[model samples]
Target: MVDSESVKSSYPKSITTSAQDDRGSMEKKQSVQQRVDSFESGEVETVIDKNIEKSALKKMDLVISPIIGFLYLMAFLDRSNIGNASVAGMSDSLKLYNERFNVAISIFYVLYILVETPSVILVKYVRPSRMLAFISLAWSIVVLSSGFVSSYGGLIITRLILGLLEGCLFPALSLYLTTVYSREEQCQRLSYLFCASGLAGAFGGLFAYALEQVHVGNMAGWQWIYIVEGLISFIGVPLSLFLLPDNIEKSWFLNPQERQVARLRNEANLRYLGQQKFDWQEVRKSFKDPKIYVSAVSQFCADMVLYGFSSFLPTIVKDLGFTGLQSNYMTIPVYVSGVLAFLVVAYASDRTKIRSPFLISASLVSAVGYVILIASNSNAAKFTACFIVAIGCYIGPGMNLGWLNNNVAGHYKRATAIGIQQTIANSSGIIAGQIYQSKSAPRYILGHSFTLGCVLVGLIGYIVLLFSLRYANNKRDERCARGMFDPTLTGDYADDFRYFL
Candidate 1:
């Protein structure tokens, strides 16, 4: 009787039953809207019936690219800034008068090579924000510590530490980003990140030029180069902690819907990678895959020329009769040339859905430039050659690495695959550094010759990968035609499973 009386009182005398039901429906709608909003906010990583906003995805890219770019810039700068130092007279001042400079620089690669493949396994387990941000700090310290070297031992030790710390970067980044963004989005994201390396190369030279003018207090120009670049790298560590999100679910900056949108995009990416299960056997299988070997071989070939030229380019410029400041300034144009090359290839590769041909074509073009650089005496010719060389050498990794990404199927495979690619590929740094000694400075014929040979070999290797991928695809197609396999299995297979070619 109290419920009836309360219901009668609560019911408005002016309202009928249908009108009351309308009020209930409106309240229900409001409750549903709240559920949608909660999902959009991504307070939880749960599934719901909601439409993903396309605009939010575009916005997410805007947020993530700069942070990823910073990582790449730092990667390029930390490893190759030593080149700027070489031009600034790192060898002469530190009295690494023997072939110790090459050996010292090469030592970084040993630690780099050892740490590279092993670090990938640890990548998924560690919080990349914590791991790589701390790594950035570690390497920044190593870079700064290089400035304190009064003896050869200190430089070698510092270089090794730099390698040890840097070992976590590119692979960790690839894993983290791919875990969130779709494959279609990956190339452009990767490109922006990689393009920053060219920017670093450009700025690294310019920075070295500015530092050369300030050779004062107790430091040589080269020593100051280390100190300054090291300081510059420190700026990134803090930004990474605050602005960076580890993956989609942890993306605090993104709303729930936006985060789901990110995850949804990568679903195709995941399936293409063969519904990747994170098993050690997959990693072992990745190692055994001949394609991995082929990719690594191609990577190694590319790096021999790339790292060789990078570590020694400044020294080479100095030998051509430019002062330290002049050599540093000269690198600006090369980097500018490389920046354009990276962007063009990146956009075009994604647009045309092509990868290998770009790398092969660029490698050969670069190989031609190396031939002229070694043979030329004209300064104008040499300067123009830098433009060509920059485009070729710098373009290879962005393209080739993207190629590796395109071919790799699962997360574990991609990790081990990229790990092997980097480890073997980076060994070229040792070879490149060793080839161009200061004594051979003005005309390091061997370095030039080796670079040309390696680039050509890389070009050939990419061609081989293309053929191999095509051959595999054909076999699969034939199997489908014979009803040995379901055509449905080939959708992500088509989109997600393209060979590195």
Candidate 2:
């Protein structure tokens, strides 16, 4: 919601006159028509009081957050459900030889990388309401199809299609939310959304366990898990359509003045990014931008390690001499601990408005945890170490993603960045799957080493981020002395435009 009564400042009147004269002296006659004056009240303020709004833009988040969350939770749950089923004897039941299950999980990332950018752009063009709803239904259908897959080829087909549908999800949700909230509010929204993944991880085990109790008519527990989760995803289609407001200003519930403020703010962002259409410029610019690349590559490595461990942990637990039921139950504490870490990181990032430090610390902690795992043989010790690894890795990508969002200039660039980030980062999925094949079960020597390497990449990426921040801050100082906009800046403060550490 926008605050209508906020005061706007542009230095003092004399300074504004001097700046105008200086601009004229530079032959840069940047004058606007009289119509521009309609929104340009000299007394307009920067602060938008949160108490003044009564729009669904205000109420919509509560409804949309859980809906989008539920959709993705199920998407990810079904994608990784094979993890649960692996221990439940999906391998034996289907006679999948030579760790094809790992390969199937890796294949999802291929489609994930391919479809992500286009899907997000589609969301921006077509509107999130329809875009997310359609994707929800599609992924639900794909997830449901997994239940009937009896052969490895069938499972692979389902995973590929599931990836294609699910790829659109997070980036679309991100672009949709950016239209409604300021950057400061974006992080809390992101955290709440990301916490759903933790919930999915925690609850997927429970869902599988509950379904195991059913064993209805010829279906296995894993099949029931996918079917139930898929059905739950379908429920979001209606919810998203009714909720998620289309184009913030069009919502009549917003006061005219509030609408004016929002429109101006959005226009400013669009100008900064320089497009009313899809901008391929961002792709080239992103390569030059240190934060974008660092965050993407580092996050890729993080996901590689995180997905590797999580996607295979249940099977690994079963191999570690735990029963299928015990393995399912054992995942609860690890995932719950991860949920705590996600919440903690979200709150801390929102409070401090910092990212790389948290990212770096978490990466180092994960490295230590993986190191501990390789050294220890005790089951309790191993569980604790893995729990630490989960906390370290699970909380990272959100902060990194949020960091990129805050720094990138517009909805399109931000959207494109997410696509690239998720795509590049997801390439690690292949490496992750190969690292933890069945041959390495019980004491997965190669898998632990791969995690250690990923943790190192994350740590190095953080270092690069620190240096990038230092360089950018110096450029800001130079801009301040020259009295020119840095061109890269947005939001209300210098620090606000910074990376999310």
Candidate 3:
């Protein structure tokens, strides 16, 4: 379905600079040439109108964001619905006693964490539209199969396979968006993606509540949860294959002029669209970068709260003395609060071009919520604390992701960094699964206290990362002022490239 000829025809043969141009103009030309040399495609630059670029951007937002968001929603719903299933009697049906349930939950992350980096690296060769859609379809089948599982061992096998299939999605989606949106524009779009998880949390609750009422044949309510959610997720597979474009060149939604604008936008950020080859050096560079490690640490801390909270919210609520059905519907409001808070913060992040302040604030706010949950015994106070925790839970992880996306430049480097960051961050899922044990029900003092510590630690990591990025920017500025900066330097190493702090 990709228009291969359109890729060739989109750019003109070449653009030549006058030999008689001024010294500054020639230096600029030399800089551009150096950057072009670093890529394999050696594409020529093209002039584009700002108005046309804006129009193209708006079209991209309309066409691309919604589909990916919906797919993520399904992915999250399938994964976190286990919490709902556990509460709805899967625990009893499968004889998931003692640590069996926790093991099933933790097993998903094992393959998930291992496949992330490699799966992201595969996106370039397989293409986004095909890769994303195919994996989604595959996982949907696993989810459908999950409904038929009758034992603890069978449940664990499905979780493992589901983890492998779904692991390809998030990192791939994150990397794909970088190709579409400019650095300053990415956070808002990413907010839409992360917001899907919040929506999933909300929608999953509603679905669980409704499905619990069904008494068809002898099937448990938990089985229906997986079966229905799996069928719903199948809707996205066809939409992704037919509607999503591989890259700007293959974007059927844009006119020829608009395609040029898309390419120009990427070029403006020193991203040579579809030009870069897979480079081992870039992958190695990602590992060497201190920013990647710090960001990974922050992501880990944030995800500890995210995965733990999402997976255990129903249980936590049920322990608050509510019926199982009451617990499912009650968690809906908490997720809605998270989505609202994320939208407000994401808009401000894009407008001001800042990330750390909001990231730190979200972490601190969630810490306070955890404190309230640990210290207070009142049901109303504890429920309010859940809302407070939700407010910051979604924000921290999303902002951290956007922060990393903004700072990294080269395609391979960004891909590797995203994979690495996510791999490390998602390992927290293992810890999250174990922290909220059945023995620690009601108050869940251990889980609450542990998450509180994670929030504060994540806050400190953000502060350190902010200062580190600012310092890098300052160092680049100093080099530029001293005339020691290399005009030929590309990607994040370029003198003009500044980190988003």
Backbone clash total, candidate 1: 5
For 1-501, candidate 2 gives per-residue lDDT tens digits of 544444232211111223435555333322222212312232223454435433434554655577677766777777777776665567777777776766777888778879887787677678788887788888888877787788888888888888888778877877666666655456667766667777777777767777756688899877777777778778878866766567776654467765765665454344233365666665556545656777888888878766776755676466567885677677777777876887777777766666677888888888888888788877667777878888887767777777677667655667777777887887888788787877766778788987788889788987887787767655644544344543344421232233333
Of 2 and 3, the candidate ahead on TM-score is: 3
Scored by lDDT, model 1 comes in at: 0.69
TM-score top scorer:
3
Give the TM-score of each candidate.
Answer: 0.82, 0.84, 0.89
Give the TM-score (vs. native) of candidate 1: 0.82
lDDT of each: 0.69, 0.68, 0.83
Which segments of model 2 are wrong by more than 4 Å?
1-45, 53-60, 215-221, 251-275, 287-290, 315-322, 484-501
What is the clash tally of candidate 3? 0
lDDT of 3 by residue, 1-501 (tens): 322221221111223355575777666767555543322232334456757676788888899999999999899999888877887899999998889888998999999999999999889899898998899899999999999998888999999999998889999999998888767678888989888999888877778878877779988888999999999989888878999888775599999988877765666555423346888888898899888998999999999999878755776677677875676678888898998999899999988889999998899899989999899988788888889999999998998998998888788889999999999999999999898887888788998899889998899999998888889787865654444547466667666566788
TM-score of 3: 0.89
Q: List the residue pairs that clash in candidate 3.
A: none
Backbone clashes per model, in order? 5, 11, 0
